[model samples]
Target: AQSVAQPEDQVNVAEGNPLTVKCTYSVSGNPYLFWYVQYPNRGLQFLLKYITGDNLVKGSYGFEAEFNKSQTSFHLKKPSALVSDSALYFCAVRDGDWGSSNTGKLIFGQGTTLQVKP
Candidate 1:
């Protein structure tokens, strides 16, 4: 089975400091990794993905992630945190072939709520 773990329930940071939200995944075969952000009463917004390439992948809102195959991890990072950046973060994974309508079910982690204090 495929799964993702977001070890942190919440992350608190002050505006202007670097921030990071950790994530790890497990899958039967090669996985399609994704990161998403959700605001209050809103749907998940795609952040970035690691299809296949350099270990580091960049995404929206100045966010980046490192894909470590050996460790089975893809941690999201940003150079600076903002109050507006405070929101719920989610790490998700799907099977390599999961994109097809037949298997487009995306399994998401519990989520990590970030509080960026001004």
Candidate 2:
């Protein structure tokens, strides 16, 4: 029943400009959110997470996310984006349905392509 949504199919930003990839989640209980980035021909790399604590959580590649409990959102942001940063990004949440046997699984969003143009 829980789901994560990346409303945009693609996000375009000029190289050196700030970039953002939107993410919103719907689930029961405290949300365990995560962000991942994937370059072409490369596997998804863990970017950041929002399991608990402060609203803002920092991660790899100069990226960070603000966990907004009121908005049910955890959008990924980078102050400045590079051409190399262009890639597919995903937002996911830990499936906490312990009742089910498949625990520790992450329910991911549809994914958003980030295009940083020089």
Candidate 3:
């Protein structure tokens, strides 16, 4: 079984400052990690993914994440924040080796609210 943890319920940052939303995961084998963002009344939008390759992955809206295998963590980062970036973020994971029967199943962490204030 795989699971994700988002320890922070909310992250507050001033506009133009760098922001980070923590995420960690556990899985039986190698993990397939992803990040998604959701607005007040919208569905989750895919941000980025780490299936393999580079330790650092970049995604939409100038967001990026670092994959640390040893620590089993994938933390989202942004060099600079924007007031428009304020939204709910989620970290999700699935076992890379899962068979077709388990397809489309993603374990997600509790949502984290990011507030960017000017």
Candidate number achieving the greatest TM-score relative to the actual structure: 3
C-alpha lDDT score of every prediction, in listed order: 0.92, 0.92, 0.96
Q: Residue 13's C-alpha lDDT in candidate 3?
A: 100
Question: Model 3 Cα displacement at 95 (Å)?
Answer: 0.4
**lDDT per residue (tens digit) for residues 3-117 in model 2:** 9999999999999999989999998867889999888899999999998899999999899998898999999999999999989999999755456574677899999999999
lDDT of 3 at 96: 89
TM-score of each: 0.93, 0.93, 0.96
Name the runs in model 2 displaced over 4 angstroms: 95-102
Instruction: Write candidate 3's Cα lDDT for 1-118 as tens digits.
Output: 6889999999999999999999999999889999999999999999999999999999999999999999999999999999999999999999988787767689999989999999
Q: What is the C-alpha RMSD of each candidate to the true structure, in Å?
A: 1.7, 1.8, 1.0
User: Which candidate do you rate higher for TM-score, 1 or 3?
Assistant: 3
- Model 3: lowest-lDDT 10 consecutive positions: 96-105
lDDT value for model 2: 0.92
Model 3 stretches astray by more than 4 angstroms: 100-102
Tens-place lDDT digits, model 1, residues 69-91: 99999999999999999999999
Error of 3 at 53 (Å): 0.3
